[model samples]
Target: MKQQNNTKTALIYAVDLLAIRPYSTQQLITKLKRKEYAPEEIQEAINRLTARHYLDDTDLCQRQYQAYINEKHRSIKAIKYKLMEKGFSQSDIQNAQEETDIDEIDYEYTVCLRLLNSRYIPSKSDKLKCQGYLYRKGFNYSAIRLAIEDFFYNP
Candidate 1:
């Protein structure tokens, strides 16, 4: 009876989360585990949700990848890292990634330039600090170097 109660609670928890947003199976499992459900119970809740199509990995990945693209304009490498962090499988990310455009480097570079202009100045002050800021933003070394070089060259 105690076990039955836990299962019901876990199920409720899963339902609430699914109602709010689609979650990868791994994400749901981790969340359920953190809520103190046993591994088996977590698995059961995830299985139930998946069977009902309330938690589709493909759909979740698609939504997340689209958001990432729209918001961050992250590189494939960075985007893959994000999806992995969000508990999506490589194949799932790969499939979703196909829906995105590649060869968008120029657009990203322009966005990077705007970001750098606001955050990083040509001031003799705080070169390291500015570098660190862009690095943290996940701009590749080449992208940063080129953007900064072109920034000054065009000025």
Candidate 2:
């Protein structure tokens, strides 16, 4: 009876957290553990949530990736790391990236162009600085070079 009550309480806590935002299974497990829920209770709550389709890492990955693309304008590498940090499996992240149709080179080019247009333009003095900034933002050397060339030659 005590174990059952703990499971129920853990489930309630998990549900409340989900109401705010989706969580990967590992994330929820960690949160519940931090709340002092026993391993068995946390696992039980996770199983219940999964059975109800309420705890889906794949869906969480997809939603997060889309938000990063549309709202944060993050690069693929950055998005991947963020998802991993959120406790999503590599396979789930790969699937989400595939579903989002994120072309690495094109996306990087677009992000670099947007950044250069909005904030950083590469002049003779600022060219290396701009390249380093883009690199820090998860863009590759080739994409950064192309974007800089496009910005200067076309603009």
Candidate 3:
């Protein structure tokens, strides 16, 4: 039947995509829709893949959080926004953070301080510029203020 054929094709496409990189369920749905797959066929493919443990949003969420933290050094807000933009649900992002048990506030301060230490030169730069940079980087005002103070006063 035409329906069966579409389902098969969708499954194959989904699997191929997953082989290249992990995708959240919503992202995969969007991709399949973009490819013009029928809604029923797309849903069937998604169900099968999820049953096969090939489409796990939770695991992907956790891994992405770690990747953003370790590789990108993003602030908590930025990481959450990026993950949500990638189609992860807010609850999933929160659960991932809980699973990791990260003290993100402390981590944010540390990251802010590290960034300041790396880029700030007392002679060439000013506190206002550093504050603006950290703000642009998604750091909270409190973290920015503390990092600036530590960089200028403690050192």
Highest lDDT model number: 3
Query: For residues 60-151, could you state the per-residue lDDT of candidate 3 as single tens digits?
Result: 99999988888647788899999999999999999988887667667888999999878877567788999999999898788778878888
How big is the positional error of residue 26 in model 2, measured in Å on the Cα after superposition? 1.6
Q: What is the lDDT of residue 128 in candidate 3?
A: 93
lDDT of 1 by residue, 24-125 (tens): 888888877777777777778778888888888888898888887777556546777989998998888999888777545664566567766765556553
TM-score: model 2 vs. ground truth: 0.87
User: Which residue pairs show backbone clashes in model 2?
Assistant: none
Question: Worst lDDT window (10 residues) for model 3?
Answer: 1-10
**Candidate closer to the true structure by TM-score (higher is better), 1 or 2:** 2
Q: Which stretches of candidate 3 lie over 4 Å from their true place?
A: 1-8
What's each prediction's clash count? 0, 0, 0
Worst 10 contiguous positions by lDDT, candidate 2: 1-10
**Tens digit of lDDT per residue, candidate 2, span 20-130?**
988899999988887887788788899999999999889888988888988647777888999999999999999988898767787789888888888854454377777
Candidate 1 Cα misplacement greater than 4 A, ranges:
1-7, 73-75, 123-136
> What is the alpha-carbon lDDT of model 1 when measured against the actual structure?
0.73
